[model samples]
Target: MNSRRTALVVMAAMLGSAALADWARPTIKVSDSFKNFKLDAVFPKSFGDWRVDENLPVIVPPPDQQAQLDKIYNQTLARTYVNREGARVMLSVAYGGDQSDGLTVHVPDVCYVSQGFRMGETRDATLQVSGDIVIPVRHLMMTMGPRLEVVTYWVLMGDEATTSNTQRKWVSIRYGLKRQIPEGMLIRVSSINPEMDKAIPLHKDFINQLMLAMPENQRDRVIGRVSVKKDDSRS
Candidate 1:
């Protein structure tokens, strides 16, 4: 009996030691690397026909809402852009160093619902900024009383853009398994237009033109470079 009990204790100690070793593994901290880059500089102030609106009233969330957002995000940027045609687009970007499940950036769907807006149709979309570059985005329609708006947004987990909560969580887990923590950013653009057909295409054009004006490195962070794999069997 004494020998059996000793063996059991030894096995438990070995398992605990293995668990500790796993937890102590080194991780590539992407957030620290991003600290040197400025998001404000990443996006240009004026691009093509669109220019930043200086007179537009700044959007301020209610105190409670602002408090909640402050807890999740480390940095945020909000701006309004107006084109020569009098079209205006509201842009919001929020970044968080810790992209874990608890500290992840909230999507427009959740934010709208919290602010008493009814969510309409939502679908995944691909934005082709150029012939060779494609970025995944989420398209959503939100309405509250007479106010209706169309929104296009995406979330970046490290270098990958993900449109769904499940995808975001999966990416987080993949990094965690690799013993790394990934930073995340939410990029959202919205316009007050009831015509979904016209609004969507305009939004896409705005995104494409804006991307063209950004630096190559900055653009990649927003829309990742696609890797084409050659078929091994063909060779």
Candidate 2:
């Protein structure tokens, strides 16, 4: 009788422990999962032949002057993406206007933040229309946290040259929460079909909430780059 009672007690204890483990959800340390990104470009060469026309007032801005513009434009891009309710984010801008004509800039797509486990993401969306561009793996690795290997894919679009610019990215990042994120929860941080201003709202709310939950100091650490729309309202 004593032996039977002891075995039953041991089995019950094992079952209880398993149940407790099941109830715990996987979680990521706020410090590790957070980061920001930034990128920008400036034009120094005169569009000598590409100039709009002699009659046109197109003239290359002095290097120093261009540098000043860089400072301002880069800051604007950062403010648009990173300074949100206190979240580390990335900002990127590419500009090259002919004095007489306009310049076409390609903006890399902003990847979506997934549930934090499993496959990061795999799809394409319309960001801007700038014809065709490449994402490249090396760049993708930089944005994704150091924990996972980088993956690449190609994205193509037509007509919407501006939207195409930011829609294509080359890297996919995977991360975890319970210290062991199940393969099922992971998602990609990129764009989807039907490029339109309205698309921004879908996941923006969730990301903002995540940022709000993080500590203030962590929020201040701006890390990555962002794509800026000349018309802030459209972005």
Candidate 3:
């Protein structure tokens, strides 16, 4: 979708005050580009005989829109991720404050924080509003279950809300990451296990394709890159 319209829809999604259905779009300041050249430039590495969809969408919510997201996230929406072999890779939101930050929201039994990406260890980077969100390249990598040394672009859009006490609140959000993985990194979209020919459909098409395209012998090696646990201090 066009940037302007996407910004409007995001604004409407916010506005938790429930005071009005009408939403005033939040002001936006997009970063020039957070794509780390130091990382993206070092491409053509062992994609491990895999391929990643260049068209996959990678848009996340801004840190300033957290307050509004509380209600939606608190809902019963299932946590989603791709399962590689026996490992369960998840996309989760980690933050400080009370358990309310994660636990209070009540996650699905199947969902979990991606391994090696500890939410607690990430530095608290201040967002546009009063709070902060995690901003670590490794963290994004874990969330996607792929070892990527690619640049990332972060776009933030927030909806402003004022309480009866005249206090303002915001919700920081991340749709997901966007990066150009090595040319041939396979992702699981849909497949059947050879042992039993059991049907397996990973929620994400890119992940599914990557899983099937890569040979079994290389799966362990390719997935290994994401297995390393970067120190939380650096996360």
Best candidate, lDDT-wise?
1
Cα lDDT tens digits, model 3, 60-123, are: 4445444544543321111223333432222222211111122222221112241232222111
Segments of candidate 2 deviating more than 4 angstroms: 1-85, 98-122, 126-235
How many clashes does each candidate structure show, in the order listed? 0, 42, 33
Per-residue C-alpha lDDT of model 1 across residues 1-235, encoded as one tens digit per residue: 9999999999999999999888865367767877776678887779999999999988988899889888888788889999999999988888777777623447897888888999998877677675556667888889999999999998887667878888778877778777788777889989999977778878887888898898788887776554223322210
State the displacement of the C-alpha of residue 99, model 2, in Å, after optimal TM-score superposition.
12
Off by over 4 Å in 3: 1-76, 80-82, 92-120, 123-235
What is each predicted model's overall lDDT from 0 to 1? 0.80, 0.28, 0.25
Candidates 1 and 2, the one with greater TM-score: 1
What would you estimate as the lDDT of candidate 1?
0.80
After TM-score superposition, the amount by which residue 176's alpha carbon in candidate 3 deviates from its true location, in angstroms, is 25
**What's the TM-score of every candidate structure?**
0.87, 0.20, 0.18
Residue-level lDDT of model 2, residues 52-128, one tens digit each, is 11232323446775575554232222212222333222222232211111111222223212313224433333222
Q: Which segments of model 1 are wrong by more than 4 Å?
A: 2-7, 10-18, 21-27, 102-105, 226-235
